[model samples]
Every structure is written in structure tokens, then in C-alpha cells.
Target: MHPLRSATAAPSRRALACALSLALFPFVAAATDGMSDARTLDRVVVIGTPTQPLTFVTDTKLPRQPVPASDGADYLKTIPGFTALRNGGTNGDPVLRGMFGSRLNLLSNDGSMPGACPARMDNPLSYVAPETYDTLVVVKGPQTVLWGPGASAGTVRFQRETPRFDAPGLRVQGSLLGGSFVRNDQLLDATAGNATGYARLTANRSESGDYRDGHGDRVPTAWKKWNTDLALGWTPDADTLVEVSAGIGDGQARYAGRGMDGAQFKRESLGLRFEKAFHGALRKVQASLYRNDADHVMDNYTLRDPNPMGPMPMPMASNVDRTTDGGRIAAEWGWGDVVLTTGIDAQRSRHRTRNAMGRDAYKTVAWSPDATLRNTGVFAEGTWTLDAGRRWVAGLRSDRARATDQRATRSAMGMGGMAMPNPTLGLTRSETLPAGFVRFEHDIAGSGFGWYAGVGHTARMPDYWELISPNMGPMGTVNAFAGVRPEKTTQLDIGGQYRGKRMDAWVSAYAGRIDDFILFRYPTGGMMGATSMASNVDARIHGAEAGVDLRLAADWSVGGSLAWAWGANTTAGTPLPQMTPLEGRLTAGWDNGHWSAGALLRVVARQDRVAVGQGNVVGRDLGPSAGFATLALNAGYRLSERLQLAAGMDNLFDRAYAEHLNLAGSADFGYPAMPVRINEPGRNLWLKLNFTL
Candidate 1:
């Protein structure tokens, strides 16, 4: 009973081509009428540039090659040392240097949007649309403490810059995309403003049908998503601003790796912010508050029929939701060459769920609260310029985290056919976590090279998923929260960046040790079907990433990057699970002011070191994954001052490949009984048009 066997027919090639033409007709017409005026236009091209070590910043409005991403995780894969654990075409969990979950602090406009699903059916990045933001910033390693807690791996921020206007004006930007597998996308951003006030709006929609692999086998990856945001700002005077914003989004996705599919991904968000400048030692003040809610529904009968002989055996559904509220206030002071920033922040979140035996019956069941989490932190960061060629940066923070468990009884399925007592019933636990980092940077005399080294330490409390999702606890413990200790990480990071007239390069490396690193143990063929246990162990990790770009001629350039990561469980003497393999990317491009063309050649080394059935919250390693290489081509044309067109072909050779950190296809999808890695999309062609005024 394969799902796709009863799925609807795919779009015909002729129909797809017609749709693409119709979508591009407006841009083509504008190009014909304004080609002579194109000199005033800004070039819109698709290849992303290499990032520097430690910190990288870029404009999110720029289009990316291999087709623009539908979500944040998909877009982050362009950066070195980053990968995603894919379940389908969208909502893949982001991983950095073999770390997942709270280790990588992700923020959208300085707000947190943690998902509610214990199994992570909707990760934080699931609600983020990268292109909707104005800027994207990445800080590697535990280099700073101003943002939030954890972040042992790194920090990612998607921000929208405030708009300023001297007089009444209107600005608009939008794009349309058409691609293989009946993929279609639309985005719009509009703003109207004067010196005293402004109104802004952003909206986007994306949809795609199931795609076949190179072997012509269909993968259950269809999805549809939409988002809309509105904001109002008041500028009382220069250096003063107050703004309020609201947003809503929803989507549905089919997964090939799980028994259930996400039928609803509803989201709502609200935020308020204020900024003001001052004289004397106090340079400025900033504060903000936000609330985000995620409501999700999963069922086996929504998108496909339940396997008659499978574990489920019948239609069923589950609904889960989480609401988070938090705020932060900070003050920035400047004294000569030294700047100091201090802030306090706090957040509270609650989770609830309902389940029913019949399809869509969950709606009739009353919701039951399962967990509540709270955290409050205070921090200060400072930067000092010792001289023209040297600088020092440091920060420290402490957080109090608390979790309350509300389960009345434990599942009896895995307790030897006997009811098990709930050891954590109405129990609450709290921990105090401290974190800090210090770094020094120096510039090479007479050269464009700068080098930096830093040391950081972080103590992290176990998150909801890690504390309550497992079926069993470690040896001698009744449950995870009752025994799991806080995780501590200490690491050293070193990197250098070089900026030259014709070439630019950067490299970053880190080595660290972890205390009480959370680990999951799964028993094979257990009575409850592979029950899991959560425990802690010591571990060591190291990784490095490097990239370079060279200008061969006035209109030609070439670039490439390489990344490698490794980890070991010192207590058990085994290689860590789900580590990304050696990866390299080579890109060549030519730009002639108005037109550009590029090619990307990606090579991944085989990943033979794996600990099967052991990994982070998102997914586990299936087995060893073979190496693969893929070639992609892209071309762009700047037609006029208000229009541009871009086209690309991914996996030009139609090579069948799967990422090492990937979800295993499900038996319900016609996959083998044994877990096997799901293949990536095959040859794909896409065209995009951009318009601005």
C-alpha cells in the first residue's frame, strides 16, 4: 500500500512549460520596453558569495542559485560547515558541526519561536521564511553572549532593518518563481512612509508537488505554505522609533520518514519594540517584547491511508500546541574606544496536546497540558579598541531555567505489560547556568589579513524534547528530567580572514570538550518497538572550515570551500553520530554588468563512520552513506530598472544521492522494511523574476 500509488497524477511537461511562460510574461514585456534604461537598475543575480570566518553578514533580498529556498534551513545549506536533517522538501532541522537543537540558537527579529511537537515535526526554522527578512547574520562558535543562552554551536539571526524616510514615499519589491515538480512561489514586500510614520507589509506563498528521484521513484515530499506580516512604526524624531508588528502563517507537509504527516502548521506572532539615543556615556537604549504560538496537527489519514499491517493499523490523529512569551531590554554605553552593553531577558512557554483514535477526532478531545518551561537571564558584553590594529571583546551571563512535568501516568506499552508509575508527576526542577567568552583580534601590519582566537564556556539545561520525549530513562533513573544533569561545554576557537584586491579567503577551526553530553540509547526489537533511553556521557569535538574566492579577470571569478567535522564519545570510545562528512564546493561565474552566468560543482566524501540508531532529536544515522557529486548551472539577466530574470538547473546529470544526516524512508512509502536513507530530488529546472519600484 504505497502512498504515491493512489496519489494524483503529476503535471504534464507541456502544462508546466506554459505556466512558466505565463509567469514570466510580465517581466519579459517590461524588459523589452526599458532595456535602454537598464543602466539605472541594480543587478539581480543568483549565486551566493563565500562567507568569512567567525562572523558573516549578507542581504537576504538577494536571490540564490539552485532556486531560492522555501525555508531558512534550506537556505543555510549554502554556508560551509552547515547541513540539514531532511524529512521532506521543507522544514528540515538545521545542524552545525554535528550539533542540533538549542545548541544552535535561532532568532527571527530577536524573537524565539520554539516548536511544540515532542518529535520535532515543526522545528523553529519551520516558521521562518528567509527572503522575507532584510538581513541574515551568522556568528560561529560560542563567541558572544548578548543574544541568549546555550548557543554552544553558534547563533543565527534573521533581521528586518528599519526604514527611514525624509519625505512621503512608497517602495515595493516582489518576485515570482516557477520550477519542476509543479513548484510555484510568490513574494511581496511593500512599505509606505514619511518622516513621522510608516507602514510595512510582507507576504509570501509557496507550493510544490511530490518529486521523483533519479530512479523515477516518487518521494512523498509535497508541501504548501503561506505567510503574511504587517508592521507600523512611529518616528517621533531623529534617533527615536517605536514599532509594533503582527504576523500569521500556516502550512502542510508530507513526510516519507514518519508514520504521520503534518496536516496543519498554524502560527501567530506579535511584537513591540522601541529604540532611543542619548548623549554622554549612555549611547543608546533598546527594548522589545514578543509572543509566538504554534499549533500543529498530525495524522495518518489526511494525506495517505494507514498501512493495514503497520504499527498504527488504523486512522488516528494528534494535535499539539505551544505558546512562548518573552522580552529583553538593553542599554549601550560608549566611553572613548570602549563600548559596553548590558541587558536582561526572560521567556516562558507551555505545551499541551490531544489525541484521538479516529481521523480528525483529536478536535473533540480536551487538551491536556504536559509541560511548562521558564528561563530568565542577565548579561553584559564589552568591546575595547586597544589600538588601530588590535581589539578585545568579552561577555558573561547567567540564567535560571525551570521545568515542570505534568504527566499523570506513564505509558504501559513498554513496562512488561504492566502499568508504570509516573515518577515525575507534578514535579518541577530548576538549574542555574553560567556562560561567557573572551576573544582578541589583531590585524597584520601592511596586510589585509586579520586573525582572532577565543575561548568560551557554556552550561545548558536540557530542553523539553530531551527531557520528556523518550520512552525510558537512564540506568537507575525513573525518567530523563529526574536524572539528566546540565550539559557543560568548554572550547577554543581560532580563525583568520584575508581581504585582497583580487582574492579573498577565510578559515575557522574549533576544538571542545563536553561534560554530561546527552546521549540516546535504543534497544533493538524491544517489546515496544525500539524503545529509547536518555543518558549523559563525556565527549570531544573538533572541526574546521575554509573558503576562498579569486578574480581571474575583469568579468570572471572562481571560488570554493571545504568543511570537516569530527566527534568522539570519550566515555564509550565510539565516534559521535550524525557528523557531517568532508564536503567541498567549487563555483565559477562571469558577469558583464547586465548579464551573468555561473556553475557550481559540489563534492561530498563518503561517510563510513556512523553509530546507527543514535543521533540528536531530529533524526538518527541509518548507515554509511556513499559520496556524491552534483553540478548546477545558473544564468541571470538584468532587464531594466524594475525587472530581472534568473534561471537555474540543479543536479544537471540527474545523479541519485542522499545526505549523510538524513531521515530513513518509511515502509508506507514503498521503501524496504529496513530503514534506508531517502534520496534527494533529481534534475530540477527553475525560473524566477524580480520586480522593484
Candidate 2:
């Protein structure tokens, strides 16, 4: 039988999934004696390619090429159709098929943790430590209504598996890493549990000094961060579970792409979740409530000496914070050949800011509230098994989205230190958005082929970054808040997957049309330098990601994947700004039960189709970026039943290149102020050790 399976086929029972995943973990077989299977090598090293259609899943603890330095964006970039807008060595912003920001729904443990940076220096992924989570799931396109709304681009979830035990026992896992540029990291996960209850703790710390680029130039990108989380669960019976979790984290990072660096990034979180199963047609019920907060401080003096000849010639700091509270309740029901899930979810976020001219002076000032955002939605998804191998899935959703502008005054966005009275002060805007999708999937009888086609639509409300960040609106409008309209996206997606004894392949492609699509224009520099204006325009987007894995021999395999995206502003007759260039990756692997090795070659094509003076809130395009290729190699060894070691050398050729989606190197770093892209890292080496008990 073939192994082709869709992500929607995930286990319906939590206990069964946990037990199966723990027992069948492939690494266990490869680390123990009496194991001689040639294919066992698949479980020994990095997983760069995927076999599932429309979804990608991987174990977070596994070693990977380029060895991410505790950053979730770095890890996600390894997947097809995904790339990071590089800032320095870490905390890059993730983009999927040219879509970023609120278009991609990012969640950690079923909760939302939005960042507070007005310029998005500290994106959502900046605070997520990949190794602390158990599984990473990416669902491309707005094809599912189970998660919250506004996911026109896709949905990404970092999950911590539910822990279950038949008897009282203690389990522990840990890893340590040391790499070039004084990079170091430590992580630990421990659990003590019995049949009726359990306690789990996860903690991690990561740090790195400034790194040199391919030109041997030192980039201001040093950072240090840490996180700690504790979870307690009660399972009165095999079919019931109640869990409570809390976490806190903080960090700081210097920047090479912007005038100011991230002086502080503090995070706080709390959550409660409940799950239960029944014997009747009502199969399962799950509920959760969570609150997350992000507090950030940006300053020019903390990381580097402020430029005496440029803007902000003195030490200046800005402190911003956002608090997000959300909850969800879902239930699953099964009747013969049909299964359905219904849920209601809501979220509220409040933002505040304070600033001062001297170091640590902002702490003495009272915070000023500027915005409040809220969303509430209800959804229903159902799947019908028409036959043994054919299925139909459909979903419907409606949301009430509200945004309040609490600004007391408006600053002349292009005039240095200029202030003006607010025009939309304390005004509230509300809209009811509807979203839905449908799909038909079939598994070829007695074959390795499976295919699915789906169509989806989502009407997205203007987020804080889009609604409030820009200083101006379209030509005649008063401001961004009153001019920018909601974005409506309709997209069609199709994919197929095939799994055989020696080959695995998958292909996914999508096309979308966006109405009233929000676009930002960077006009000529004014008194305060270049400023952006928010406007609405029609747009077209399309992309495709395909992969194939071939096992030449029992112990040898080769794989390759390619991703390409394209977009155009139909209203302006220009290419879309910030579109990702074509990218491809090739990998070759060889391993025995006791040892494993692999090589990765990444190639990025030049992006020549760019709307030079337009983009999103992150930044605008800087002409065309040239293409480049880099190679990375990794090796691993099973030291014993409870221990293992892995190492990697990235950018082996030390070729200098910058991504298309990049911020210009800041003048504070001794670069010309002509908006040149920041170069990536040079040759790097790292080693890691993992242990389990």
C-alpha cells in the first residue's frame, strides 16, 4: 500500500495520536541495536522535502541544514514556497508566495502573539523558538475554516503534543548547540506524569555575536534570548483532558538594516485548554482561552553609536506594547460516513506606545493608547466519504471585525518633528466579513496517486500595520485610517501526491485575484526622508511549488524542490512589489542506521520584475537583486541509545548575495546610504548534541 496521505487525515483522537507518535518515532529504531534496515536513514537527518499535498509537517527536534539559531523563521525557510526577508543573521520575516503580515495566520499552541513594532522589526516569528515545540504544520491557501479568519495566504501552527502516560514515569529530552560567530543555544524539555495527571516544562536559551558576511564585513546582528514554559494537565479518564500553560520570554538584537535596533523584546503568555470525547455521534469537544503580550523597545544608542550626521542625532528610544486575548471552542460530530466540526473563536488586541529622547527616559512617561482591534467568528466544516476512497470537504465562516483609532494627534509623516491635529481621532470602524471554501479529493484505487482541487475566498479587514502605519492615504484622502479599504481575495488551489516504494512526489499550485488590495507607495524623500502612502488597487497573484524524492538505492536518495511566485497590480499595470524570486533546492543523502550525511544546494533566481517604489509596511523593493547559489553539508552520528551528535557547514563557497525581499543596509553600519541590500552570512559551522532519557 502507498503512504500518500493528506494533512486533513490527522488523527481524530488525541490519546491515540500521542501514543502512536511516541512509540513509532523513527529515531528510536535508528539509535538502538539489532536495527539494520537501509531505509532507516530517512529518519536520521534533516527533512527538507515534503510528500503531503497542501500541507507540510516535520519534527521540530530533528537536526536540519543551515542549522537555525533558535529562530522560527529560519526553520520555516527550509520549506518550499517559503522565504525570509533577511535583516541580519536572525529574526527575519517569513513570506509564503509573496504574502506576509496578517495574510498568514501564525499561531503558537492555538494562541495569538502579535508583535508591537510599528516597523515590524520584531515580527511574530521573532519570539518563537522552534525547538520548544513538538510539531510544525503549514497549510497553504485559505482552504480551511477551522482556524481564525483573514488567512488568505495560509496558516501556520506550532503545536505541542498532548502528553499521556499509562503509569507514573519521568521523561526528559535536551539539546545543546555551539556554532560560529560565538553562537550558542541550550534547550530542555521534561515531563513527569501518571495515568491521571502530568506536568511538563520546556525551556531554552540562545545567543550569538555579530557575524561576518561573505565579504568579511562585520554586520551588527548580535542577539540573546530565552524562554520558559510550564504546563499541567489532568486526565480523569482516557477520553478527557484539561491543561493549563504559562510562559515568559525576552531578548534583544542589534540591526544592520534599520536606524534603530531592538533594545528589548519581552513576551508573556497564559492559556487554558480542555478536550473531551463521547461515545455517541458527538465525537469530540475542545475549548481553549489564551492571552499573550509583547513589549518592545527600539533605540539607536543601545546597539551602536547613533549617527551624528543623520536623523536622530541624539539618543532616542521608543517603547511599544500590545496585549492580545483570545478564545476558541470547537466540537466534532460523526454520523456514519460523514464528519463535521463547528467552532466559535474571538480575539481582542490593544496597543500602546511611549517615547523619550534620552536613554531609559521612556520608562518615566505614561503610555498612550493608539489602537484597539477585535474579531469574532463562527465556522463549520464538514467532510463526507462518498465511497471508500473518495471524499468531499466544505467549510463556511463569518466574522465581525472592528478597529478603533485612539490617536489624539497626527504627525506629518514626511516632515521631521512636525505635528498636526488628528482627523480620525477616536473613530471606530466595523465590518462583517464572510469566508468559505469547498473541495473534492480522491485516492486512486489500488495506486499511489491522490489528487484534490479546492476553491476558497476570504474578505480581510485592514490590520493595524495597514490601517494605521502609513502616514498618508490615497491622493485626496485625509489619512490612511480613513482611506484604506478591506481586501477581498478569491483563490483556487489544486494539488496531487504520489508515494511509492522508491519515489515520492507532490505538486501544488494556486492562482488568486484580489480586489481593493492594499498597496503602499514610497514617494520622493520629504523633510523627514522617504514616506509611504497606503492605497487600494486590484491585483493578481499565482504560484507553484513542486517536489520529488527518488531513492536510487536502499541507502541512497536524491531530492529536489522548486518554488516560484508572480504578482501584478492590475489597477496600475505594473508588476507587484516585493515578489519573491524563483528558488530551487537540490539534496543528496546517504546513511546507515548508525550514521547519516546530506548535502543541500540552494539556487535563487534574479528578481527583475519589481515595482521599485512600492511594497508593504516592511519595506519597498530596491531595484533588482542578482541570483546566487550556495551549498551546505550536514552529518550525524548515533553515539548511543540515549545520545547523538550532528554538525553542519553552511555557505561552503562563501559567495556574497542578498535576497530580493531585504531591507537596505543602514548607514550606522558603515554602509553607503543608497539603500543597498544587506548581505547574508558567510561560511559558518555548527555542532549540536541531543540526549533523551
Please give the CA lDDT of all the candidate structures.
0.84, 0.84
lDDT of 1 by residue, 248-295 (tens): 999888988777888888999999999999988999999999999999
Candidate 2 backbone collisions, by pair: none
Q: Which 10 successive residues of model 2 have the least lDDT summed?
A: 1-10
TM of each candidate vs. truth? 0.95, 0.93
Worst ten in a row by lDDT for model 1? 37-46
For all candidates, the clash counts are 0, 0
Candidate 2: Cα lDDT at 109 = 95
- In candidate 2, how many Å is residue 280 off? 1.2
Instruction: Give the per-residue lDDT digits (tens) of candidate 2, residues 301-359.
Output: 87778789877788889999999999999999999999999999999999999998888
